[model samples]
Target: LPLKPTPPPFRNHGNFVVSVAELNRWLGERAEEAGAYVLSETVGAKLLVDDDYEQSGERSAGGEASGRDRNAPGRGRSTVIGVRTGDKGRDKDGGRKSNFEPGSDVVARATVLAEGCWGHLTGAALKGLGLAAKDPQVWALGVKEVWEVEQPLDRVIHTLGWPLRPQARFKEFGGSWIYPMNRPGETPRVSIGFVVGLDYADARLSVHDVLQEFKLHPLVRKILTGGKRVAWGAKAIPEGGYWAMPRLHAPGMVICGDGGGMVNVPKLKGIHYAIRSGMLAAETLYSSLKAGSTDFSSYERAVHQSEIGKDLYESRNMKQPFGRGLIVGGAITNAMVVTKGRLPGGHWPTHRDSDQPLLLTDRDKRYPKPDGKYTFDKLSSVFTTGNATRDDAPSHIRIQQRVPRELAEAWKWMCPAAVYEVPEDAPQGSEHVDLIVNPSNCVQCGAITAKGGRLTPPEGGDGPVYQVT
Candidate 1:
C-alpha cells in the first residue's frame, strides 16, 4: 500500500525556508568531522591533467601511485585567498597574481564545479577539452518575480497552476511559492516564475514578456491583486536530460548542480540532485586520494550508479515529444476546452505516450496538406491574383486601421514603402539613420504611379487614401 499523507501541525506557516549561511555552517561541521577540509568562497579554476600518468600500468590504473614530488615546480600546493585579509599562505597562492588567475583562489586535489545556472567557467573548461558543445535545444530560460502583497500575512497559501489556456503542456517546469517568513508586520512575499523552452532560435519571445503574461492570468491575478512587484529577474535553467549531459569526470575535476544540466523537469526538483552530486564527488575524490591514486574514473561510476542518473535517463525517454507535439497538442486541447467548456475526458492532461513523430507530412492521414498552401482551421489563408494584390501585402497593413489613431497615423505617413525611399537629408534629418531605411534608394514607386497611385504628397488630407497593396 502507498504511504498516507499527513497534515502539518502549523497552519499557514509557509513553505520550508533555510538560509545559505546556516547550510554552509552545517556542511562545515559535517565535513570537518569526517576529516575533510572545507573552504568557503573558493572558485575552481581548471582541471589538472597528468599526461605522464600512464594508464596501462597495473598499479597506476586503480591502486596507489606516487605522491606529490615536492621538488616539482607546481606540486603539493593548492592556493586559496583570504577574504577578510588579502594575504595568501604558502599552500594557497601557487606563484600566481590575484588578477592573473583565471578563476577563484580556492584550489584542491580534486575540484567539483557546483555553480548553479551561471556555470560559465565549467562550460569553458568542457568546451576546451572538446567534451561538450553549447546547444539551445537543451537549454531553457526562467523568469521570476517577487511580489509584496497587502493580504493577511498569517494565512498566505502557495499555489501552483498549469500553464495558461492554449499552451498548457508548454507549462514551464517550475512552481509558484509564497513564503510567510517576513518580519512580524511586514507584507508577505510571493515568488512566481516559469521555465520556457529555448527551441526557437528567434529572439521575438522574451522570458520577461511571458512572465508578465503569467501575472495577468485570472487565477494568478486574484492572488496578486493588491500586490506590487518588488523584484524580478531571468535565469537560464539547464533542461537537457541524459542525452545532453557531458562527461561527469575528468582527471582532477567533476561537475554538479545545474552546471551538469541535472534538473528533473517533471518533478520540478534539482537541489537534491545538486547536493547528492557534490557529496558523491567529494566521496570519490576522498577515496581516490586515500588510495594514493590519481585516476578519477570511480567518480564517473558512482554518478552512474546514483538515482539521479536513473531519473534523468527515464525522464529523457518520457519527455520525448516535449518540444513539438506536447506544445501543439496542448494548444489544440486548449481550443477544445474553450469551445466545449470542459477539459478532454474531464481530466487534466498528463504526460502522454509520445514515441511517435511530432510532425505530419503529406503521408500522414491526420494532416495531409497535398497542396502548396499550409492549411489549418486556426487561421484562414489569403490568395493573390493581380500585379498589386491584397493577399501579397504585409500583415502590418491589415492591422493598421484597427490600431490607435496616433499609431495608425504614424504608420500611414511612415509607409514602409515610402520610408524605404526617403532621402538621407530629408525633413527628418538623417545622421543616425540606418542605411536600410534610406527611402531615396527605392525604384519600385515608379510602378505605383503607373497604377494611378501617388507615391508622394496629394491634394487631399495627407496624400491619397493608401490602399493596402
Candidate 2:
C-alpha cells in the first residue's frame, strides 16, 4: 500500500503475515491480561433496544421518532442496550438435547459488532437504526488451503488475470495469493488461495472450481508440484469502499472491521484498521460511559478524522467501475494505481451485488473437475475443515417459495458449501429445477444469505469451529 493518495505520513509498508489462529490466540491472551471477562462459544441472540419514548414525550431534533419506537426497529434511532445470548444445546427439534435452556439477556452500556462479513444481526441492526449504505455493498468468495511443499519458496506472491472467463470480469480487481509460512523448525510451507468475486454473472461459477483451476496455472503449478495439502476453508469479503459504509453509530452500538466494510480494496487489508477502530471505540467509551453520557457520535467522528477514513475516502471510486466491464474498470484503475489514487475524485453508484442479473443469456461454460492429488472437489475439501454441524439440526436457511428456475440454479453455484442443489431425478430436458437444501453442509459463510436466501442464526456452537491460534 502507498501513502501518496493519503495527504500525510500514513503510508504503511504492509502487515506482518501470520495465521489467524495464532493472531486470535495472542489477542485472547492479551485481553484476559487486561481484565476482560471473555465468553466463548456464545452467540449474540438478539440486540436489546430501549422502549421508553412516552416518558420523554419527545422525538429526534427534526420531529423523527426518538430512539424507542417499538413498531419499526430500523427507524427512530434505537439505542442498542445489549444482546441476548443464544440458548445452550438449543435445537429446533424440540427437547432433542438433554441440557437445553432458553437464551438470556446481557444488558450493557454499549455493544460492538465485529462479527465478520454478512453477520446475521448486522442488517437488522442497521435497519433498526434507520441507516443504509450510500452504495450497495459487493462481495467475493475466497477459497484457501495450507500446504507443506516439496520445494520451499521464501517470498510472498500475488497474481491476477487468466483462468477466468470474461463474464466474471474480475481480472483487474481480484485474484490469487500465495504467501509462505514460517515455522520454528518444520518443513517449509505456504498458504495458497484464490478469491473470485461473488458478483459473477454466470450460474456455472463454482468457487471450488475456480480455486482448482487457479492451481493448474503454469506459474502456480510449479510451486505446488508435489506439495501436500493440509487444510481448506472459504469466506466472503466486502469490496465496496467508502461510499458503501452505512451510518456507523447505532443508538447504543457501533460496528468495526469487515462487518462494517472497512477493508481497503486496493491493499486487500483490514486488520490494522479493525484494531485501530476498536481502540478508538474503547477510548470514546472510557470517557463517555465513565462520565455517564449517552452520546456515541464521538466514535464516528474519530473514525472519519482518523487515517482509516481518509485512506478509504481517497480511493473511494476504485471498485465499482468494474461492474461495467474489466476494460473500462481497468483503464480507470490503472490511472489511479499509476498515479497513487490522484486520478479519481468521486465514486459511481452500483447496485447491490445480488441485484445484478443472476444468469448469463449465452451459457457456454465448463470447469475442470478436481483430480484428487493436486485439487479436490467441494465435499472432500470441506471434510478437511473438520466442520461437524449436527445432522439433526433444523434448516436455518429460508428460501422464497416461488423463486424462478434460473435463480434457483444460480444459488446452487453461488454457495461454496454445497448446501444448495437441484434435483438429479428431474426429467432430461425439463425446466423444472427443484431446489434442495442440505442445511448440514452449510459452514455458514453467509454467501447463500447474501444471494436472496434468509439466514436465521442457528443454535449456539452449531457452525464450524475454527482454531484460535
Q: Each candidate: what lDDT? A: 0.41, 0.69
> For residues 380-462, what per-residue lDDT tens digits would candidate 2 score against the true structure?
87777777777776666767634567777777776778887777775656655677788878777777655666565677777
Q: Which ten residues in a row have the lowest lDDT in candidate 2?
A: 53-62
Model 1, position 119, has a per-residue lDDT of: 48
The TM-score between candidate 2 and the true structure equals 0.88
Estimate the Cα RMSD of every predicted model relative to the unseen true structure: 21.1, 5.9
Worst lDDT run of 10 residues, candidate 1, spans 377-386
lDDT by residue (tens digit), candidate 1, 1-469 = 1112311211333345433334656777988998977643232333333444212111111111132221222322222111111222211213444333223334356656675653434444344433342322144555444556766344433332333222433333333434433556667666566554443222123333444545555756666777765444344556655555666655566778777768875544677788888888879878988987645667766776898887765555333334344555435434443443233323221221111112211211222232322111101111110112212121111121232222222222222133222234433532232222322222122112111121221111111111111
On lDDT, the leading prediction is 2
